[model samples]
Target chain A: MARLTTPLTDFYAVIPAGGIGSRLWPLSRADAPKFLHDLTGSGSSLLKDTWDRLAPLAGEQRVMVVTGRAHRAAVEEQLPELADLNVVLESEPRDSSAAIGLAAAILEKREPGVIIGSFAADHVIKGTRFFNMAVAEAVEAARAGFIATIGIVPTEPAIGFGYIHATEETELEGAPSALKVDSFVEKPNAHTAEEYVESGDYLWNAGMFITKAAVLLEELAKTQPELHAGVVALAEVWDDHAKRGPAVDKIWPTLKKIAIDYAVAEPAAAAGKLVVIPGEFDWDDVGDFASIAKLHSSGYKKDLAILGEGARVLSDASSGILITDTGRTIALVGVKDIVVVDTPDALLVTTTANAQKVKSVVDALRISGRDDVL
Target chain B: MARLTTPLTDFYAVIPAGGIGSRLWPLSRADAPKFLHDLTGSGSSLLKDTWDRLAPLAGEQRVMVVTGRAHRAAVEEQLPELADLNVVLESEPRDSSAAIGLAAAILEKREPGVIIGSFAADHVIKGTRFFNMAVAEAVEAARAGFIATIGIVPTEPAIGFGYIHATEETELEGAPSALKVDSFVEKPNAHTAEEYVESGDYLWNAGMFITKAAVLLEELAKTQPELHAGVVALAEVWDDHAKRGPAVDKIWPTLKKIAIDYAVAEPAAAAGKLVVIPGEFDWDDVGDFASIAKLHSSGYKKDLAILGEGARVLSDASSGILITDTGRTIALVGVKDIVVVDTPDALLVTTTANAQKVKSVVDALRISGRDDVL
Candidate 1:
């Protein structure tokens, strides 16, 4: 942690911002998705928080945010210090691989050997000191030409996220704790998640990757040649500043819709060109109201967690979350683990046990022709 | 039911409207009560429903409604056909004894041998044909010099309502089914309610009473002389039209705040002067969300019962009542027997099992100084 303050001048943080998070229901809609919300109750949107976390390490010049065009204005409004060149507006979604690959290609063209770390815009991370230290180590490992990922030390058997299997006793010169990557696995059931926790060799894949920009593009060129050529062709003309828009409009939609985990990370791990650096920081995707409630409880002692401003609540024997932004008072009685989301146009009531099924509510509404609320 | 179509010309119906219904919070508030809302999902309000149910039996001119002075304007708005003189406005709350006693005394003065029936404005009565037949028989028994009460045939062992104990059938002309009421019992325990239901002698005391106005006043005079005298003095000037307001303002607050059951019906039943005509009508006090949900299900087969207009509901695996007038769409997933009430300033979420405890939400609001919402 002591050697972490010098600032990684060559580091570029790339934020791939997507996902509607339907499991969060009325709060996270299609037009105004999860990355745009202030899920931490910190009075700042998650996109801005992501910028805040990254800008300190890479400065605004090297910090980049790639989001859909619908959210570009909101992202600009939230991050007042962000320069226009650092923000990439997608014409449409083409999944994580295309989004992150384009950022890696552009930064590699901007400054070859520039170290880039991609972090999701909607995730919450605590213990900034430990995160800074882990990123410093990952940057050191990335300089050794290995695509380095910061794996979170598992605190519980969370069945909501993907896990990374790291083999022991392998290290990079500058990073003492860097280990060889074995595989990237899917979200497990409760029993398998518990077994993974007990193994002590697995960590949660935070979808955070640190590597030299040239190394990421080289790997993409080796595995997905067409995708690499398309992004690299756009990145070459991006700084010409005149042909950038036309070049992106022509080539962006043709890129494949696939996640980076499937396109690059898994194959690289299988080929022994991937490395894992474990991070000791608290993180959550804020997947549902239950996760937000748990995050909210860490700040207060009340059994009930109330979000939004100036909304009064009177609850009894209830453990749940009540969310309202319209200044409407919510009164809950004799309900446990219930989720009440009160907005101006919609209201949703269910329990935490049905957290994952909240997407079904959106699906049902879509099927019922409630597109206005959606 | 065939003998019920002819109008009961001499029967004056008195509707005593009160009770804020704290158990149905956010929907039932201090400024606007349950009786003013359309809890039935019908186009009209409960007060108007009460008027609609009574107008066919006793013409609009003979129907009387007694309510608080604060609700006088709303009552007038809902019951536009009601004559100005027929609306008895209480200066303040003096409970049912004084409210109904004044209506009875006034109707007795307006028409000398008038038979008056007191029905609650907030109760729901189905099977109008059978209800009319029962009231006709009760009126006949009332004409025979006995105070008559309608006893609802219990369909379940509900422990929420009082039971009426009736003895062997007595001889009454034109009222063959009328039996002498032995006593009026309070709400019983679950076991006691089951026993009372099995005994075949007990019926639910629906708080509906019919009698000659003169007989009711005389019984009131015998049991509670001071209360009877105060109401009688007020009634004497009530039809003076000019002096009615000043007279009621002077004498109203002096009367005791006691229910009519304790003041006259219970004592009269013990003295063998009370008779019960068993009614085979579907009756509900509309006590809580469960009752309203049940009433709603009988009309529509949807798992969720939505009350009022302009509420779009998408529910899955849920059965309960959703009351919203704010035009907000409510999406419920995986919850059963849930009660969600969405208003402009407040919202409430609970289940049918906790219906009776909703008053505690109001109590908690009062304790927490949220009087604006309450």
Candidate 2:
């Protein structure tokens, strides 16, 4: 993978920022989602980090953001360099298919054959050099008339993420590291995930798709004709400020809620039209406190890690993570693998082994009509 | 033990309110100690509870509190019905010997042969009828010229508290329940405590000392003459407003720092002048979160107990206690036996197993110069 110095010609980056990240409740609320937070100790919000990462590959002017109307102001404020016309604000969420498809349709409407790359705003990626080279190869693969997705090279036999089955024999002409996608697999059981990792033929599907805007819309048209038609109709009047609101209000809600993988990528893979670029860079979804604890492992003292700025923590014989949004002094004593998330209005106490079960807490809160904390 | 109806004549209650309760940190601070908190969900602070428990036995006019000057305002506010002269404010802590001895000396000066019963402000006692009966019998034993102390009947082989050895054959003339004290033992090891509990000759020494003010002073004078003389000097001018401050500033610091058990009870036990009144009422020192959890076991939902007013908590598959002062919505998921104390400035996260180790956290904070939170 060769590192490119300049932005790829006609390559547009589209960031679809949605999902409340319920597992990350108290920190990631309905109003303030995970993308708006700095889960990594990166000093910037995930959305801003995403913009910065893509700005080098697809110049600031060519990058676009597709987010819900509720987060439009926050997204705009976070990325002030973003052009007014580039941000596609959805009236309501119809899942990833509608979000990415609408961005592609609008980009195609603005300029035909423009190569667009869709990246999730909340995913964290390390190794800038490797990331740039992977994106460059992905863009090259996309230029070869195939839908390209960057699949993270598996570091562990993780059952938490979906995997992409790729073949080393079939390769795109221009992109050397690119492998033909055989299929996309859902999150596997412990045994199956071990087998996948051992075979060395599968990669973690990180939802980074790169392809020509026209090709994506064309794929969407073949698979989900109703959703493609609805997005296309909305895109036609999207540039017209007076007509955009009315068009979205009429068509957005009617569109079926589906993921991009189920609607486009999986079908394309079956048709032998999709290619996967194995990204060697470290990546994380920052899904829970356990991931956050791993990301900030460097800050751990005696196996205890403290996240968030101005977190005053005193730990003794404790092994775990303390994520404090409020500047309260948190003291931990003889607790092993514990997670203490201290916020102004809400607090979460659990253990690293039980990080995934935090979703149950949020679900219970919602059931108990405690949506205010959510 | 027979329940007494009226307040006993010539008996005054002196509560020695001290100890920062470092093991209960974030909830118990230096300025706001455990005595000021309602660790048991009794709807009032431990100090106020002590006052209430004693007012029935000694009457409101006969009950007095001896606390540090820093906590004078708070103690006065909590026990507003207390006469201004009865609240003894120590300029600097000289341990239990000085605090209790000073109260006794002052009471002796006011009225000769006055019986003063000393109780800690932070202890929790249940079975008011049994407690009143114990106090009445102890008062009878005190009138018979014995340094009477109420010892709790052993419920378990607890190594956390000191034990009293009493001889049932040698009984007080007036108080039939009172037995002659053979010795006072410090906290024993697991095996020794088990033996003591099985033998049935031991009772938990709850630091409840009842004796004539003159007898307490005379005992203190023999064991710690310098401390006894200093307190007697301070007591002479304690009633004079202008001279009280000067007297305390001059004599309080010179007094020896010693517990009443070391200065009087232990020595008196050896001399066969101490009598143990077996108290059948359940008693607790409220020393740590583990004890608080046990005291509030009724509030446990799926093994999780919450102690505090207006504490909004949501727990799932989690056991242990949450003591909240900040009224935050606390959610615990898949954590067992965890202790979380949420305060305005400081928060503590541990487990019931690690409750005793909380003292180390406070020690670390103090060494790091975080006295503001302490």
Best by DockQ: 2
- Give model 1's clash tally: 0
lDDT of 1 by residue, B1-374 (tens): 36566579889999999888888788988879889988776778888998998899998888999998899999999988999988888888899999999999999988999999999999888888888888888999999989999999999999878999996798798778899999999999999999999998899999999999999999999999999999999998987879988887778878988999999899889888999999999999988887788788875535788886867888777778888889888888777778888899998888878888888888888888888988
* lDDT tens digits, residue span A1-374, model 1: 47465569889999998888888879888788988888888898888888888888888777898989999888889988888888888899999989999999888887888999999999999888888888888898898888999999999999989999986646577788889999999999999999999999899999999999888888888889999999999999988879988998999999988899988999889999889889989989888888888898875535788888887777787887888888888888777888888889988898877888888889888988888888
Model 1 chain A scores worst on lDDT over the 10 consecutive residues at A1-10
**Stretches of candidate 1 exceeding 4 Å from the true structure:** A1-3, A299-302, B298-302
CA shift at A325, candidate 2, in angstroms?
Answer: 2.1
Clashing pairs in 2: none
What TM value does chain B of candidate 1 have? 0.95
Shift in Å, residue B104, candidate 2? 0.8
Q: For all candidates listed, what's the TM-score of chain B alone?
A: 0.95, 0.97
